[model samples]
Target: MKKITVFWGCQIPGRLTFLEKSTRLGLAALGYEINDIPEFGCCPEKSLIKNEDEKLWLLTAARNLALAEREGYPLVVACNGCSSTLKTAYVKLKGNPKLLAEVNEKLWEFGLKLGGSLKVYHLIEFLADEVGAGVIKQRVQKPLRGLKIGVHPGCHQNRPSPAASFEDPLNPRKYDILVQALGATTVEYQSKLMCCGNNLTLAGKLDDGWRMARVKIQELTNLRADALTVTCPACFMQFDQKQALYARQGDILNLPVLTYMELLALALGIEAEELNLKEHRVDPSPVLRKAGIINEPLPFNEEVLKRCLTCGACEYDCPSARTGVMSPQGIIKRFLNGEIEELINSSEIWECVECHTCLEYCPQRFGMEKVFTWLKHQAMVRETYPNSLKSGYEMFVKTGRLAKIDDRQRQKLGLPSLSSQEPRQFVEKLL
Candidate 1:
């Protein structure tokens, strides 16, 4: 077995210790022994560099890395900020002989060197590479059959230059594929690709966070998603535990935010208490209950649904509208004019790609995708819809496929066909 130093850092223990524990459990189950390095302090995140105290952050991160170096193992960080800082510092100090001198001068106080002896890694990187999703799939003992989940791969983990090479920044399926191995269905929604409101949270801007989250949740809810799964701790806090505050302010949303480890824990047949499911500030029990994964409804408070402001913010930013798929603005206007009931059967509504761009740009916290979702649900339930959707709908119903382009057409356009004919069980499971 390979030796690896587990750097819990500080934030994971304070707020997301469950994730830390679950990760350890997940990796251990995969036959890896992770040695804990607890003496290391905070990574100081971006502040050390932003404050022009690169030595401080470097020393702090290096101290952690040095422990791993001494232990003859690479350091694995669970926090995004810590992971970014450590990896960046390692590369930076290793490249510049001058910066290396400066950082080493500080490290000399603790008898350490600022050389390239330590390697930094994020847990997800290892999971995607060494441990591999195949191993995870094989380890799944409890298949989450009735769940429809949305994955939020947080900006730091796979955005603005990914932390890992294997993680495709723009389109990631590591988390989703792992979820599938556990017997759950992953739903692609408008906000599935959006940022997790981390910037808004850091700026002490609650409204921005609320608006961003509200739009995201509305889209996921519209898809009838059981939960919004995440890999970042800050993202887990922002989306999972902050809903009640947003709801109290009148923009009602019911979406459970779960950590990737929690999902893995459930799949590994770990009990709820061992996974720390109770500590989530947001009550996930309702969504779980609705998915039939649990018995009782979560203690989520219900609020009176407010009428959409019809501001067309969602329309302005929606890619579908830009691509001439549907008039998101027009739908809002028509709905306000008491024509939504009539518009449900129209192909215009089904044309939405379910991207939450409109929600991001909307001045009001109105989730327009929810309207689209409601329309889709009504169509499926009532069996009333347009002929234009017949192609996609039949593909979904008969072949468990969605939006498959002709193979010849795709080759003609120099594009690879990404669509596949899925199992009927998977499609029906989602519905």
Candidate 2:
């Protein structure tokens, strides 16, 4: 049996204890041996601490990494924010020798030093990449067919491309693929990519954060989605408890929020009662009722991915495909076959400029451009991307603009000063 250490962030152990059950029991049911480790601290809450003191955040995360590495086990995090924070620390410590040395020096006092290869997985990363979706589906005794759910990709899981290297931050479909693995369907909504604003809300912007949550809930209701599924506890709380509070004063068309493991547990034949589904703030009856509904069977969930396997419709106009630098169909085929980690260093993905010539004539409403874009993002995460993109991404994230506007240069050129610190200040808050 494969052994993995489970990192339960602050929430699961203290407040969301049921999620701990779901994650532990669900992973065990899926053929994994869970190694329980008690000597772990908070993921250090990135927005809370990182923005306050980056050195402290990095040191804390590094200590956790050292502990996991010392045990020689793959660390699987149960929280999105925890995964993001640790990955961020990993990238910084791995890339900067000086910074790593400083961290290790402090760690030596505790008899711990950060060294050796570090492998960490957010729940979704472990599910989609490490444990193939096909393997999960094969174990499903009760397929969730006919249940239309909405997915809310939490914020921390996407930003700082290098930190969240498991998938494309822009076009993340691993969650959707994992959902479909259980025979359920996912709907696309306008607020699908919008942040739950949990961090914003927690960072003293209550109304603003709740506003984002309301937008997401409203969109999910409009589409009649059974539930809003999330991998992060903060997101689950933002959507679930906030809606419950909203119910006290107004009409919040009962929308349920389920963590990935809770849903996975159900598909694996674990009864709802066993997982304590009723403990949720918002009732999940809608999700339970919608399961296996006998409506006209919609097309299988991954129709586009499946069709791309053999269809060469988008290849004719694809400049990269014609030259044999990269093939759209081949990219799709490899992705569906779960070769994502292997494809991380592939430079040929940068050849496409997302020209929509393939979309215009394709029947699948998809194109090779879509595939290439996701690959480019993953490439950035692994730091294997071309230097040109690396600098541009860094500048944008740092200053909110690709180029730093020079007030002095503008003055020399007889142009008005075009510089503002607001962009940097704004990004600092998000950082």
Candidate 3:
């Protein structure tokens, strides 16, 4: 049996335990053996990297990869951030012989040499490549049955990829292939390729964060998506669990968000509870219940902590706020407001489209979407009608679409018209 090292980062253990389960089981079901890298610890993450200690970051990553190299197996990471960091460190070292020597010199302390021979892959890439989508397609006991699904791959995964693999970082389809194997249809939304607004949480720009998710959610809802699926835990937090946070201030948009594994597990005949669907802050139970997968709604948790330092790094990178709706100043006002809950529940927070601009900029590693997610949960509890989000909610309910603009809107806006049959499709066409 072939075996690989599982790099379980910090977030997977504390925040996304089921991801570990789904990846472990999903791969096991496919006959690939996996083992935990016991010597491994935190990837030090983006937060620690900011301390300006490039050498430490490089050495640590090299050490982890070397562990896999020593065992003569490839290194596999479940977290998008970790995958990006580990892969980037390897690339940085391999590309620069001098830096490689320095890092390797440090590695000599641990009885390791960094020649960068280890292969690091994100879970999605490994599944589509190693497990073989055809095999997954054949094992679909409970296919998604053409259920509408939206995908948001995190930014870090592909930002550094000069040569694309698995899927385009800007427009990922690896998850879509798995979704299709489960008999689901993927949504073609404007921000479908956008980053989740997680990074913005570190910055003080909550509004910018909200708009990123809002834009994507609004698009997906307009596309009539049944649910949103994401690979990264942070992406999962922004798009799926934060709906309630954005709903409180104004209109509420209801969309069930699930991990790629949870969906795969459901298709593989695993129970919802076992996959931790109930733990999602956005309350996916109603959506799953509506699909007849569950009889009753599961409990929804809204855990709001203290205010983030409000760095506004989220606004710095948000594409929507950069283009429309919430401006930089507005982001600060919401995050700096006296009534934190009211600020979070406000309609301004509902405008995000889930693009990951904020996550890309935040120096603090705060989750910019928390305010919005908390608000969405509050609105759900109060049974309040979401005013800012009505149009999107109605769109999904009406057309099974997630975009307000159709081919006609494209034409009116002077955007190239998509052909009914072949206007031009890229990601899906590639698949």
Task: Give the best candidate by lDDT.
Answer: 2
- In order, candidate lDDTs are 0.69, 0.81, 0.68
Those runs of model 1 whose alpha carbons end farther than 4 Å from true positions after fitting are: 1-3, 47-52, 162-166, 286-431
For candidate 2, give the lDDT of residue 170.
80
**Candidate 3 structure, TM-score to reference:** 0.65
Ranking by TM-score: 2, 3, 1
lDDT of 1 at 346: 69
Taking every candidate in turn, the Cα RMSD to the unseen true structure, in Å, is: 18.2, 17.8, 20.9
TM-score of each: 0.64, 0.67, 0.65
- Cα lDDT tens digits, model 1, 1-431, are 66678777666788777778788777776677887766678776775353677667777776666666777777777766667777766666677888778777877788876557776677777676667778888887655655778888766665445333346777877767777766678898766777767668778887787678777888888776778887777777778667867667675676788877777777777766677777776777765544334433212212212244424455457888776767776776675565644675467777777777655665555467767776676554334566566567777776676655578888898999655655766776676
What clash pairs does model 2 have?
none
Q: Candidate 2: where is the Cα deviation over 4 Å?
A: 292-431
- TM-score of candidate 1 relative to the true fold: 0.64
lDDT of 2 at 16: 92
Candidate 1: 10-residue stretch with minimal lDDT = 297-306
Question: Which of candidates 1 and 3 is the stronger one according to TM-score?
Answer: 3
